[model samples]
Target: MTASPTAIDPAVTGRAAALDWVELSGYPTRRNEAWRYAPHKKLAELSFGPPVALTTSVPDLGDLIPALDGPRIVVVNGVVNTELSTMTGPTGLHLSSLLDARREQPDRLAVHFDRVKSQISDAYMALNIAFGGDGAVVRVDAGATLEVPIHIVDVEVPDETRNASCTGVVIELGAGSSATVVETRIGVGADFGGSNIRTTITIADDASLEHVLLQNVPASHMHLSNIDVTQGANSKFLARSFNLGASYGRVAYRVDLAGSRAHADLSGLFFGFGDQVLDQQINVVHSAKNCTSRQTYRGVLDDASTGIFNGGIDVLPGADGTDAEQSNKNLILSDRAEVNTQPRLEILADEVACKHGATVGQLDESAMYYMRSRGIPAVEARRLLINGFADQVVDEVSIESVRTWINQRLGHDDV
Candidate 1:
């Protein structure tokens, strides 16, 4: 069952405003346009228990996650582990939690929470706010650079089917500052267990942030997440995501370019096998002048799996000089594999340049034959072709260590 108001009162949910949405309208269903392709029967079969504090008994992180070049924030179960996190980060970088922010930066936290809460639009987000325990707050001061990328590693142990993990993260970058944040998530068990995470980001004027997300859960677990980003004037926000494994996974994104000359770039790859189903909903709004946004997502489906990409770019009135591009291409490897893609554009502004395209196809037999003629086996040729299709997204990671780690995970790295 979903997190209804009857399951837990909104009064005791958190310190913010009461989450009355559940009481107004129950959980999501197939009728909910965003969840039309989801397996609703299994979603209702899962339940999230109350949040708890994690101890020092962390999982084998080295084996589950990549070895990056920066500080790490470990979230065992659903709470952040201090014993594993680097308390002191690079210059001008600060770390705080929900309790810490409430105790020290109460007004700031309240303002941020208010801004992000109004943008919420789904039941998964409601569940996150109602059941999410102590959340993480990451901030970077103005005019300062974070020396290295900060990694947030979230792991959920296999437990009772009724138990799940819920957490929230808030990232704020001051004006003119720059940093990279990588989120590595794994360990949604094969049982009926699941994970619900919500992250909100704000980039100040002239600031820049590079965000990367990695989701490689089990083959029969539910993984859900929501990301909301607001950009200021001259700000730059880049995102690269890889969704490898999940039985029912939905990654939703809402980006608002609220200032002139702001840019938002998102590139993602999803590879599904077995009976897995992967979906993405990306909505980028251009409410400012001279703004640009781009979305490029690729899907590789094998076995009896399904993939869906529903993306949109909206340019509101008076949002002149808006330039946006969207593309989604899927490679079907098995006869039973399925793919449904939609890339749309809604422009109500002047001097706007918007374009979108979606394609679903199989491997190129000519390329396979060319490779096999050069002493490469047929199986090896197909593998290389798949890697080449995925590299378009991976090559944009920028960070060497993170890119290397991704290559190793995708089995594309040379020994």
Candidate 2:
């Protein structure tokens, strides 16, 4: 017998109201331009039950990446596991559970919570706000520079319930503050369920933040994520994403340059093997003058996998001196694989400078042949070429451990 969708806890009145509102608004369909290429039918048909918190042993991270000396927070099945987490750092760096923050520091959480939510009209984000579970809250005090990186690990435990899980994160960087955050999402078993994650980030004036996201879940699970960022004057934000696992995954980013001279750099590398489907959407809006934005994305598709990249840069009116660039490149390794890439730019300001381009093609046969003719095995040569193609984005990663881990995951040594 199959399980049915579970009901929201009546005790949680706020979540109940949000869920009601989401249901009334309805989910996205193929007719929606933003969701045209997504697997709308599959998502609409899936019965997502509320997740049940479970305590399980933490998995080893040694095999995934090098051991870094820093503070780490772990969340299992949408619930923060305090026992498994380690925190040792300077003062004024606040890291705690979102729920705890809300109860303890309601004033601090009020302004940042859902600040960018209104700018986005996505139904999934509404669903996350309604039914989302526990997540992390990171705040850096002004003039505090955290030398060590902070890691937030989200793990999905195998269960027969087949429920859906949601995680929400809020990050705030004060003026002149600098920090790095790494988020890793991993799954444990074959019977894992789906996940919905929403993150809201705000960088104050003169602040800097470096963020890295890794999604490595089971092939049977579905994943949906939305990231919204707002930058203040002269602030800088950098983001790097890695999508390596999932049966169906969609990641969206919305960045707003609200302050003059603010800057943002976004890059991603995705590998779609087997029958996986990966979709990425990025939208950057220059609402202030003299803001700069750059985006670069690369993908590798094999077997019957499918990949999609839709990136857009918009320079609004009166935003003079805006500079923006966007590029997406994909490599198709198998005839059965498919990819769709679109790069768009809208310039309402005549004084702005912008360029957008995309390319979708297979490896160069001539290069492969040349390597093979030089005594290199054909398989090894193909691997080498593929690695070289992906290295362009990997090499941009500033975190040494993350770069090394990604290279190893992509079979860099074999190549």
Candidate 3:
């Protein structure tokens, strides 16, 4: 006889729900508003085979991993690599693998799987829920404050036959806790198989978190991610992100400010060149009173590259005294470069403040002329201008090592 609902195993039930979702909801198309600016052809051509276990030795990072001194976790090809991961100097902070959690504490990830499904119904999320048997799990205890940041690294290794991998990450912070976390995603080879990842973050009341996300996948890889966040009363969330590499890379964020006096400060920089297609989608909802959010993103495109930034801020009917702002700036360095930016606001509350703006333009020729007149070479002048444009977001990164790493990816030596 079949087990009752209370007796059903969480892992099996979660996978069954995910399979049902996969069968019911297929991949998104261009007609879908959220995917309107996405590269539908590239997304369509992606081949998601099965998850490949790591059989060979891992390759060297070689300047890809940043210089960080903290507790670290590494996920390779949708599986955790214990040989390269370390946990130190942080008490009350815990790390575990998704496989272990499913085996021992089945309720941890099963709830998040259901939460993500309730919030969004997408093929990538469904794949992640169904095939994500291994990854990283991080949790901080109540009233614990960590000085060192936790670094989580994700590496994608190309398979001989070109397959796909799916992974999941879940971060939780208890009440009155404070910590910093960094996430880095990079690929090993040029013939990279696609990787789909899902991340969920939950912050309790009066907690604080600082986050950094960097994606510099290989040239021939496709990187897709879904990040969902929920904040409690008086909690604070600060994030700085960079999307500098990948042939077809996209990151979507869904943030819900669920409690009064919560605040979110977020910013990102997307620099593309060499026919790359980079995209970013951000949606923030103010669900409680006196919650505030700000989004500032910049894009720099060169060669025949394409970039898109779609951001929205929504204030619900009961969310009075909400304040939100959004800004998107683009810089095109080549004639063939293109950028599509849209920043919008929707308000159903009477007493709320919302503002959004977007601008797309080229370098200041007059500034270039002035710099050239002052003995700065044309190439150096252009580099300086582009660096200056991107520094606005880079400077917001609180960590110096991450700042230097991002500068290197952007081809700038210094901040």
Candidate 4:
């Protein structure tokens, strides 16, 4: 028998009530503006049974991404696997499993757990919070600066039957602290499954955080992710994402600048091939004065794949001196490929400066011909032009190992 949406699972804690609340709304349909481009038919047809106990062994992730000189936390099947993790770091850095935090640091968990739940009405996010299992909890003490990056790896072990996996991550940066966090999602097997993930971040006054999210799961899987961030006064948040895998993937980001002089920079690159579909949505809210935000996204589609980009910026009535800009550009490599982009801006403050634009088109034939006339082969010329277009976002990645991995994926490592 198929499991009901309100059924409670033993693996998750304090989520049965949330599950029941989400059941009323059910799944999203094409009528929902945020889910218009999503593959609702395929997602709705699948019947995922109740959440199963995470009994699979942790897969070796050493070969997935290049090794970096920092601490690593690994999660397999939505559960933390300490046997495969290296959590040693600076004196002020603390890394532990969410389950452990709930047991030993209940006070801290109580302060942030489900705090943003009421603010978010998205069905997928509600479902994630209702069923998510243990994830990583990372905290940096005040005035501490970590010299190395922290990596969190989430992997799915293929199951013969349809199932669901959910994970929740909480990150807090204390006042005057700074750190870099990298998250990677990957899976195996050829069977269809669902992966739901959510991450909430809080940056205190004068703190800074550089976050990188990479999704490269199997082509037979469907992935949904949500990232919500809150910034304090004079804080900085930089986000970079790369989506190059998954049969149908959707990622949404909500950033709120609640403090004066805060800044946010968001950029991403997505490549789709075969019959895959990728969608990226971003919403930035300026609620304080003297804040700034910038967003730039680029996509490349080949074969019969489709890509979508929707970004919006909003300035509140009191958010004077707000500066925001958004731009999205897509390159189509085949006649069968398709792309849709929408950029929106709502300015209620008279002193705000905001602009938004989007463009979808084929590669520059003139540039391709110019490279070919210089004695380059057609294939090489095409690759060179694509690489040049993608480098605009890839170059902004600050971490060396991540930069190298992205370059290798784009076939620009050697060049």
For model 3, which pairs clash?
none
How well is each residue in 137-182 modelled by candidate 3, as lDDT tens digits?
8899999998888888999887665656777788899998999989
lDDT values, one for every candidate: 0.80, 0.80, 0.83, 0.81
Cα lDDT of model 4 by residue, 1-415, tens digit: 2243243233344465456556766777878778888998777644333345455555567657656778888877777889888878987899998767766776776555554446655666766666565678899999999999999888876476566577778889999999999988888777787677788888999999999988888899888888889999999999999988789887788999999999999999989999889999899999999999999999999999999898989898899999999989999999999998888678888788898888887879998899899999999888888888888888888987888888886679544
Question: Which pairs of residues collide in candidate 1?
Answer: none
TM-score of 3: 0.95
User: Could you say which candidate leads in TM-score?
Assistant: 3
The TM-score between candidate 4 and the true structure equals: 0.93
TM-scores of the candidates are 0.93, 0.92, 0.95, 0.93
RMSD of candidates 1 onward, in order = 3.2, 3.3, 3.5, 2.9
RMSD of 1: 3.2
> Highest lDDT, which number?
3
lDDT of 1 by residue, 1-415 (tens): 2333333332352423325665666677878777889998887777754554333356667757777777777776676778877756888898866545655775776544453445558766776776666457889999989878888887766455545677777899999999999988787445557778788899999999999988877766688888889999999999998888679877888999999999999999989888899998899999999999999999999999899898989999999999999999999999999998987689999999998999999999999999999999998999999999988898899887777777788889542
TM-score of 1: 0.93
Which ranges in model 2 have alpha carbons more than 4 Å from their true place? Answer: 1-17, 45-50, 55-58, 115-118
Query: Which window of ten consecutive residues has the lowest lDDT sum in model 3?
Result: 1-10
The best-first sequence of candidates by lDDT reads 3, 4, 1, 2
